[model samples]
Target: METCSIARIIRLQDLAMYRHKLCSLLFRLLPQLQGFPPGPPLKKLCKDEHVHVALTETKMVGTLPELPQDILMVIFAALEIPDLVRAGSVCSSWHSAYARLCNLGQYKQSQTPCLVYASESDPDNVLCLYSLAEKRSYKLTLPQPPIRSRYLIGSSHGWLVTVDERSEMYLLNPITCEQIALPSVTTIEHVKSIFDEYGDVCKYEISWHTGTRSSRKPPSIFALAELRGRLQWKAFVFPDTSTGSYIVVLIHNPQAQLSFAKAGDDKWTWLPPHYLYEDCIYKDDILYAVNIKGELHAFDLSGPVITMKTIITIPEHYDCDSRYIVQAPWGSLLLVFRIVHDHDLEPQPGASEYWNTSEIKICELDALWTKIKVINCLRDHVLFLGHNRSQCLSVNEFPALKENHSYFTDDNFLWTVGHTNNHRDMGILNLDDNNMEEILSPQLCSNCPAPMWITPDLRKMNLMGSMSQQP
Candidate 1:
């Protein structure tokens, strides 16, 4: 009987210490609860005082014990990215919980599309992320090597692919601050310096001079010309890297040809050239490209030797002026077209001179990739198309976003000399109503990079064996 009584007393003492520590943590975490009664004042209890009495007193006055970690996790998981970050700083347990939830990929469930833009005046290579759901803007600085000095060519799986002045490539995750350096510029087969002894020539200057002298210029003359530069990456798509190997497809050079390189390969491998290539996408381990004639070509990247096959040819009567291919959340392919009106070459007083997106047409491809069906309504899906990447999100995942609408940024001929600072060209296209509404206002910085949609994700790349070159 004596031993049992001693054991009970020891257990009570440990419980008391735990309760005190938890209350201290809570008090530090929640400052607003300072004025709230913090239970009976700590005092030396008499030998006769029962442990039940102390626990009952704490139960009546303290609120920390009522909220367990499991319950707290559910609450934290529902918070937006910004709020969740703040909650992690409150306590060590909460921070651990946040890390666990992130490892489990629960944070991605709360993510929505955000508009990422760069400020011409920000010296620290900062990019602004505007949240459509919260209607707020967050400034984020990318990690080294300086991202502002590089050109953003593509964005996929929450990572931005940037090419530096020397034509080197890097993958940057603005949200996680993680960066992966891909193969060097010289690894590309056809990448050569225009100025032989200048080490590496600036391709932008060469392309700009060439564009100025061209007579029969393309409608999206400036954008297409810039995209065709040798140093410019043109377009790139990142594949799933969880399988220990991944392929990066790029359309580069003045000819806009297709090339690819495996994750650890020292050099890029050239594929059969597709000139005047508008866009490319990777769906189910296969690469697909669209040319000026709206012909779709597929490449099987799963094999040791990549083989290209012509899959679908869009009818010439559809009159595909500008084309982009996007895969829906449910694994369906969509072809989006931007139809423009070619008015007089000269501008009139009080009128916009640049060509605008007069109409948008969407077409759905069958599983066999044989027939194309025109889709007037997008149902519950919203599409975001831009120079970086084109993606589709289901309205069911983000209820705040409007359904059957297309959000677009500056692409192709939308950016002209006179319309450099205008935001009126980029807007939301309502597929159901056939109405376009301006979504973002013009920024004060005139040289800001065109805005693009970025989906926040926290997955880190396996860069253990990857090669990197110092800038």
Candidate 2:
């Protein structure tokens, strides 16, 4: 019995010594592994036989002692540009992560979504970057004084475009501050009438897209203009009641059918309306629009007629009406609406209210439009103010949550007000783990009241001015 016991003790001691050596080798090679759980595969790889044999043999399966910055950069570079901006708030290390990640090819295919929030106090608008990846915030300066007395529309390929109260159209780069004034009418006649009568009465809408099969280098910008004039409509009778103002702009495809009724003209004319309804997203040629019922519709730009799909719906009970719907970085659509809920008006017992006056709802697109959450009471505007709302939107689809159902896992978006101050915030909500982090708040900028809007064209590396000048 004593002999058998001695043998067993010796065997156990040998196994303990082997495990200790294996663990030491693994820790030396991949220190980051300490943070993760030890699975069977790792255990097998770290076994006594595996460790010394692999180290002694001429062949090592994988690289060892990985460079932290280089791996961070790879993870950083893989992130969408906007994500780096959001990551800026995490810490100084992440801020450095932000700068190194801005390589040219990152945004070659599609631009990042950048918005310039200009305060009357400051001549230039504050160029705030909303990264689609990390889904956070950072600040940049505008190229020149944004078209004064006009609403800053957005940018395409680093070019910033805007329209004024007088309806004047101007395009510039916020980064380099180069401004270009486009002609009143590119080719359409209704636009000419609006410009002539109203002195640029039509408001300019900008949609930025990358080249299709024809061009692969830089992205293209599509300008959409809404013309409000008395005109004819085939869909409606004399003076179509269904139509208040006709949308007249250069089509994205330049081949889609466009019909317009000019001011004081008796008849409706046919033109291309490809870019009229929806904003052009660069990834695929899918065009997106929101119908009167407040449902998001998407169609192929190359197709003859758009077969619109209702990606999401705005519940009628949402209280206030919604104007725009923006697709968020994390595979979800953000629906912005103006709600009028009275504070003095007592709330119903056992009732759940989302927002105050203007409510912003984040809905996950994949699963049935589940209202992930909403932001109602934003800093000090009591009595439910339904002022102005627009969609500052972008989507990044990487480092996604393990489960597909979790939409908020890695999503980000932007919102710019018309009259209210340009207050911004970065929100991070992971439904999978139910983890939500919001840094840099809208309330922080309540003192800096500025009107800002988003530009679709967000490319990195190039100066904003040169990017605008590109073909």
Candidate 3:
């Protein structure tokens, strides 16, 4: 009996040492885990959960059902993107722990990007998210009016710019499922709602004119169903640094015009420039816009008056099908040119036509020299360019991403009409070889919104704090 007790004591001592070493390693790696407690990094055990490790000297011993949930979370949180996703799939207990961490607003600093699209199976309400790390598609349900019917023009800071059936706009946070209504589309200076005999909005008459060269052209009439998405080419949402409230910049039709609205504004304020702005981005409190002719402009909305400052001269040729602006990982600004097939250089965008992007050319803006330099290789960064806000992520941070590659989606609005089920034009492009290969399964490829990329996040917004001050 004495010998047996001695053996138990040794076993307990071994277990104690093992736990100590495990904790020591985790604490050392804690500094690397982002969003860790603010102060000195330390192992924080969940007080409610104790494994019941006894020294055996007291003649008491117990076993845990599994590793403590809190410890499992710490280890899972520190894992690389793919491993963390796999860890959650290991067992039910692990999944719960992972879910808790995700629910706790842990959109880790290096958030992994997910392919956001709508599926026909549950098209009206479900959003299909394809995770690159896990190579799996997950469905998330957003608040009412169904994501399928809405036009997702852009996604920024985890919120999507959705245009509803009434041609009204909103900012929707996919993870937290929060919605903020924007100014009505009819509020634009050129948009007029045409009411039917029953006093319901059935059509819209929007004025169209060419920049600087043409007189006012006859208005174009669009039915309510088509006008919902046809009104805007793209939209972007950003926070006004001065007020902490959000500002939404829109690239609308009537020739890709520029307009903006504050968080609580009753109407959108036009920027007065009609240069056919193709894409826009907000950085360092300045809004940078790129036009169809590759001209770059900057606007400071906080001032008493908004003036469009020309940063770069207009390009001589307009061969590039689409132009996108993204801030590089290293802080330099880049302009990406997406070109489709050679034969389809001037292909008209028809209601049912699909566009498959063929090649992508990147150019870095030499701000100091005021010239654009063509970059043959993206180096360690990958570009996600298409309908969603243009994004550039580093390859070092996301191991799943291939260097010098571009993952593109169908930014063409004509193919993504809510009423139809059409195959999307999305694929991964190898810059080195200019070869494109599809990665999505056949089913996911047939969805609405055309497979744009959005970085998955669970950050809760302080809607009250985001309310804009009276302009």
User: Which pairs of residues clash in candidate 3, taking residues 3 or more apart in a chain or in different chains?
Assistant: none
Question: Candidate 2: what lDDT?
Answer: 0.34
On the 0 to 100 scale, the lDDT of residue 191 in model 1 is 42
- How would you encode candidate 2's per-residue C-alpha lDDT over 348-464 as one tens digit per residue? 776532222222333334446645356432221111011112223212212222221111100111122121232232233233333434323444333222323233333322212
Candidate lDDT values, in order: 0.61, 0.34, 0.68
- TM per prediction: 0.73, 0.38, 0.76
Candidate 3: misplaced stretches above 4 Å?
Answer: 1-107, 196-202, 209-215, 314-318, 342-354, 416-423, 464-471
Misplaced by over 4 Å in model 2 are 1-115, 124-147, 155-160, 164-166, 176-189, 193-283, 303-315, 323-358, 362-450, 453-471
Clashing pairs in 1: none
Better of 1 and 3 by TM-score: 3
- Which 10 consecutive residues of model 2 have the lowest summed lDDT? 228-237
Give residue 387's lDDT in candidate 1 (0 to 100).
65
- Number of colliding residue pairs in model 2: 30
Q: What lDDT score is found at residue 426 in candidate 1?
A: 63
lDDT of 1 by residue, 181-252 (tens): 777665665443344356544442222112113324332222212432334545564653334445677766
213-249 per-residue lDDT for model 3 (tens digits): 4545688898876786567867877767766767889
